[model samples]
Target: MIKNYDVIGDIHGHADALHRLLARLDYRERDGAHRHASRSVIFLGDFIDRGPEQVEVLRVVRAMAGAGTARAVMGNHEFNALGWATPDGAGGFLRSHSEKNEKQHAAFLAQIGEGSRGHHEALAWFASLPVWLDLGGLRIVHACWHAASQACLAATCLDSAGRFHGEGLRKAYRSGTPEHLAADVLLKGPEVRLPSGHSFRDKDGHTRHEARLRWWDREATTFRLAALGLEDRRSELLDDPVPAECRYEEAIPVMFGHYWLSGRPQLLSPTASCLDFSVAKGGVLTAYRWSGESVLSNDNLVWVAA
Candidate 1:
């Protein structure tokens, strides 16, 4: 069985950073795909949207994944791309082509051209990615790793191999469905609603009524302490108690991305790590070299300048 892995963070179309990181990890590009003698890559998705090189990033990742050198999970951006391209059985798409949505996806569409063969192929590949991976020794997901949320997907959306099928894709995007909630929590991290009259503007200037929870923080009890990736606005969050359901109590080493973390790449806890250093936002592309250690370490974190 494979024991060594290079768990990578969100790419967000930064192919240069990705290439640099792979080289830094000693992976060589061979036969149009990067591979290591004994190590494999676990890509934490978000391979498209924002930044330049969207198609290039997909090409490299798809080649490697296709050649069995890497495994990947679907990020929210990939999911959104599928929704944007899929018909809703009415006149509109699952994800509308509103100005805001288009603006967010402009870079990818500019590169791949909506409705092109490349776009359809990319969407098909995205549909094939698992929402999460449990490798017995370790687990990987794009965001939060909640058992109940995964169970929801297993029941309504994911096939035995964890990919979404036709009816599953439809239900996964439908509002008020268990599959929808599962997709949201797994791909975009779990969130906790703020107290009435409490809210904050996100990085995109959108007002948010809920804060992304630090689900891995098993000791956190209050919202103020449980908020993730919003250190600047933590004071504005209510000191209200965090719901018990938001806690992550598992012991398996889980490596995930999508938090847009900053600073030197590091483990969130002994068994939890967020590899995303916001490469799409002029930050680093981080990875962790795992050698089958049950407890993760900061020393294993490796990254390249963006």
Candidate 2:
């Protein structure tokens, strides 16, 4: 087990920024892999898509993880890649070859050469990544880290070796099933449908019907308060906080990425934090250096300019 960890946020194929962040963390490039003398990286994932150097990012990260200097959890992009590539047992892909999924993955495909041998190998590797990581003192997920969701995946999606592959993996991505919801909530965070007659344009200017909630705020009692942690536009969002029964109530030192947070970085809660700072969208790539602390501090946060 690694004694110290530099929990990194979503890279989204920003390899240059990832390298800069590693340099800031005192990691040195050695023997073709990034290494820190006494520390290892726990990547929160989203290493592909939306950036200019998708394949290079994969090369660097895969090399580090292969050298045992880093560990990574599967992010939503990686999961989507698997789903998009899998066979539906009929005619189409497991995720359905739609324009939406294709557009979302265009950047990645552009850099990696869609349907090339390298792309297929990368997708195969992505299929083997675990959806979450429990490192005793530190817990990491791409988005929300719910115990129930973790247990559900463990029982339904995980193989003996803890990989999300084969039948279980496909089942987890199949929409409308309990397995799908569990995986979605864990990978994409908890979301609630906007009330009838309510809608909002996201940061990308796409109209969103369902909104991702602030999973770290338990006392957000109004719409503005509840939307405090959302990464998208909030001006048109419903001014309604989620019910108390739906909020995250844990005090564990959990760290996740995926929210395209901007501006100054800080803990989402005393023990909960988001590592993503929207590096793919010209925001900085961030990381939270952790060493057995139950309560996190903003001082531990690090970043590299996008």
Candidate 3:
């Protein structure tokens, strides 16, 4: 077991910055893998896409995890990659290579150059990654950590080894199914539609009516307040807050990366922290040095500016 853990945030393939962050974290490169005396990294996935050095990021992360110096939970990108790679028995991919999906993965696709061996290899490896890690002291996941979704994962997605089984994969990709919702909520966080005619442009300028809710807000009274994170948007919706069932009730501290969070890294609550600092978008790549602390603190966050 890791004596000390550095929970890394979403790294959308900024290898140089990642290397710098590792150095700042005092990790040493030995035999092509980053290591520390008693510390291991818990990668919060989204390791590929949308930044320079995609392959380099993959190489570094793969080496460390392969060398037993790090552990990882699957992010939405990885989960999407698996679907994009799989065959759907109808002469098409499980997740069709549509404009939206392709655009989201353009950087990663450019590196693999489309449907090559490297692409398939990446998907296989991603399928092997667990969706979440329960470390007893804390929990780790890509996004939301609702217990209902966790149970859904157990019943229809994750196998005993924490990997996805073949049957589970079939179940998870089915639209409107419980398995699909579970995977979606876990990987993409909880999302809700805004009031009629309410819409906003995201960081990428995509028009969106659905807002990803702030799962950490236990007492949120409005949709604006319940928003998962801050983003470049038109304005707050000011609608009704998400229902009680939509909020997280887990007591275990959860550290995750997915929302492309910006600004200084900080805890949403004493037991909730977000590490993603939008490093791929010229923000900082952050990590939380979690050393058996039940109550998380803002001071423990570390980063390297991009």
Candidate 4:
């Protein structure tokens, strides 16, 4: 069990917000010396893509990890980014997002130089990230634990092996390929199946095969979690306890990032929490400090204005 730690949500290349947030959290270099303390940062992943400062963010995080001030898990976006760096297919999400850092990407590629030690080192670092970290009773992952496959579980079960397996998973991040880049789809839940013989219609009365995922709004007259089935494309509201079949229950308090919670971080379930606040979109990057049984919010670490 880490004595005092802070769990941060996805930064998504938001270096400015990350810096601001870290300052608010009182994270500092130990005056040219290394020190172990009661506080450390646990990044929940998604440190790249969909934001402007991927390179800067990477450099800072790499430094922090080297200094033992912080640790990070592998987010799906990072996996996608690494996959794009490979020689195989178009790197999918990685390639598409490379536009944000075309120059840095090129420089990074050049430094690595094909078949050189730099190449191997870069890949090794990317590949060696952890998928999930168990801090005492708290668990940190990029996304929901329920969505994790047996292979993912196997890779993440032990700390040493988990880090290696996580690196391998990052290296294999490609969509619709044999390696399974769509881990989110696998973990989020099965595609909704339409009711038998029921035709699907949108609120606008248009027919569709897929239903949109639901957003939880406390102020809404009807506050509930729902899922859409493919056939009828209709949403069914769930009960308060939430069905055990929903894949929310696990062995520990799972904190993750990936899902954009509109503007606020979501305290989804007592066991599951999402911290991504879209910092790049002028939203806050949040953190929750966990003690024995209480989760404390350091709102001062919120980088963006409300």
What is the TM-score of each predicted model, taking all chains together? 0.96, 0.92, 0.93, 0.67
Candidate 4 or 3, higher lDDT: 3
Summarize candidate 3's per-residue lDDT along 34-142 as a digit string, tens digits. Answer: 9998889999989987887888888888889999999999999888888887888999877888998889888898987777888777777798899899899889999
Candidate 2 per-residue C-alpha lDDT over 106-175 given as tens digits, one digit per residue, 9 for 90 to 100? 8888788888999998998787788888888778899987777778888978986657858888889688
- CA RMSD of each candidate after superposition: 1.4, 2.4, 2.2, 7.0
Stretches of candidate 1 off by over 4 Å are 229-236
Candidate models: Cα lDDT each: 0.90, 0.84, 0.85, 0.57
| Model 3, CA-based lDDT | 0.85
Q: Tell me, by TM-score, which candidate is best.
A: 1
Candidate 4: global Cα-lDDT?
0.57
Steric clashes per prediction: 0, 2, 4, 7
Candidate 2 lDDT trough over 10 residues, lowest sum: 227-236
> On a 0 to 100 scale, what is the lDDT of residue 263 in model 3?
79
- lDDT tens digits, residue span 76-164, model 4: 66555465555454434434545544543544444335456655654666666776676777777776554444354454332554653
For model 1, the run of ten residues with the poorest summed lDDT: 228-237
Candidate 3 wrong stretches, greater than 4 Å: 229-241
